[model samples]
Target: MSSTFETVAGIMSETADIPRETITPESHAIEDLGIDSLAFLDIAFAVDKAFGIKLPLEQWTQDVNEGKVPAEEYFVVKNLVSRIDALVAAKGA
Candidate 1:
């Protein structure tokens, strides 16, 4: 697995109390792992601290709330991994 996926899985493991083995690229944060909105905020904060990348939590949430971004897009593990990897690459660049 990519470091981005590992880091995200680790955070979800702790925040959602789900086993690391159970977390997969296709896992849905809300449906599969039972991560609520508040837990997601905590996960976002943890990701920022762990990777030194800032996720646009407020903006993303607003977009989702306003129906601009689908809620499922935000809660899918693979999608989050892709976004984090992009951010990390951007930071390194």
Candidate 2:
């Protein structure tokens, strides 16, 4: 899991142009990462490709865009972490 997080952070740093040190489990996707909508989409695609798990960005955008994320806005890194957590939990490994 730690390795996964590191990989995720690397991806965000490289692709999203966010600083690697800016990422942590506690970092808010929007507030801390500063990712806009298009960046969010790019992050989502990158995460899916890197982790080999398909995150449903369209549905996620609909929910998060409508202010349903409970954070009042979108946060790409946090969403990526959530998706990773869900997929990891589902596998029961």
Candidate 3:
């Protein structure tokens, strides 16, 4: 996998208290893992701290509510990885 993927999975595992071994890039944050809103926020905060990049979680929530993006698609682990990677790269981190 990628370093970003590893870091993301590690953060998710630690923050969400889920087993790292069971987490995959494709894992569904809600359907497969039952990540509640609290857990999702916790994960998002951890991710922001880890990557030193502010995640637009509130915007995503707004988009979801506005029917721009489905919540399920946004909550995928790979999506997090991709977003983090992009943000980090853009920052030249």
Candidate 4:
């Protein structure tokens, strides 16, 4: 797995109490990992803290409302990693 994915997995594993080995790029956090809305928020917060970049929570809602990402892909590990990678880059600039 990529380092970003590894970081994300670690965060999710701790935040959601999931086994790290089960987290995959393709894992559907809500459906597969039993992550409910509150857990998702916790995971998001953890992600924000781990990377030292505030995730654009409002923008995520906007993206969902604007159809930027299909509902299914929104919380996928790889997709979330991509979003974090973008923010991580921006923070360094």
Candidate 5:
């Protein structure tokens, strides 16, 4: 797993009460892990703190609301890992 995946899995484990062992790239935050909206917010906060990068929360929500991206895609572990990798690379660059 990538470091981004590890970080996200750790955050999910803590915030969503899901076991790290069960967290895979295909895991769905809500369907597989039972993460509710409130828990998702907490996970987002934790991710921001851990990575020292601010997630584009407003943009993500707006995109979903505007039908740009499926709302469920936001909670996919692989998608989150990819996003985090992009953010980290952009920050470094």
Candidate 6:
């Protein structure tokens, strides 16, 4: 995995208190990680800080409340991973 992926996963694991192993690119933040609103906020905050992306809190809340978890996770994690990858690339570039 790239350092960006490792860093994202590591922060996610620490913030959500989920095992890093369980937080694959396919792991659903709500279903697989079992994260609630606060937990999701925590993850978003951590991700923002870790990747230098200023994710808006209000937008995040709206997304979570509307069940639009960044990637709309259901059975796969590819969408979420792609979002993260885009964020990481933007930050790095």
* Model 1 agreement with the true structure over 34-70: per-residue lDDT tens digits: 8888988889899999989999878878998899999
Candidate 3 per-residue lDDT, tens place, 1-93, comes to 998899888887888889998899899888888788899899889888888898888898999999999876678889878887888898894
Model 2, 8-47: lDDT tens per residue?
Answer: 7887788779878878867776777787778777777887
Q: Which residue pairs clash in candidate 2?
A: 29-75, 30-75
The residue pairs found clashing in candidate 1 are none
Per-residue lDDT for 1-90 in model 6, tens only? 666667767877898788888877767667777877787678778878777776555765577678787436322345544556676678
Displacement of residue 85 (Cα, Å) in model 5 is: 0.9
Deviation in Å, model 3, residue 63 alpha carbon: 0.8
Q: Which ten residues in a row have the lowest lDDT in candidate 5?
A: 71-80
Backbone clash count for every predicted candidate, in the order shown: 0, 2, 0, 0, 0, 1
Any idea what lDDT model 4 has?
0.84
The residue ranges of model 6 lying beyond 4 angstroms of the native Cα positions read: 56-78, 88-93
Rank all candidate structures by their TM-score, best first, as comma-separated numbers. Answer: 1, 3, 5, 4, 2, 6
TM-score of 2: 0.72
Q: Can you rank all candidates by lDDT, best first?
A: 1, 5, 3, 4, 2, 6
List TM-score per model, in order: 0.89, 0.72, 0.89, 0.84, 0.88, 0.67
Off by over 4 Å in 4: 65-68
Error of 4 at 16 (Å): 0.9
Better of 2 and 5 by lDDT: 5
Q: CA lDDT of 73 in candidate 6?
A: 39
Q: Is candidate 3 or candidate 6 better by lDDT?
A: 3
lDDT accuracy of residue 83 in candidate 4: 80
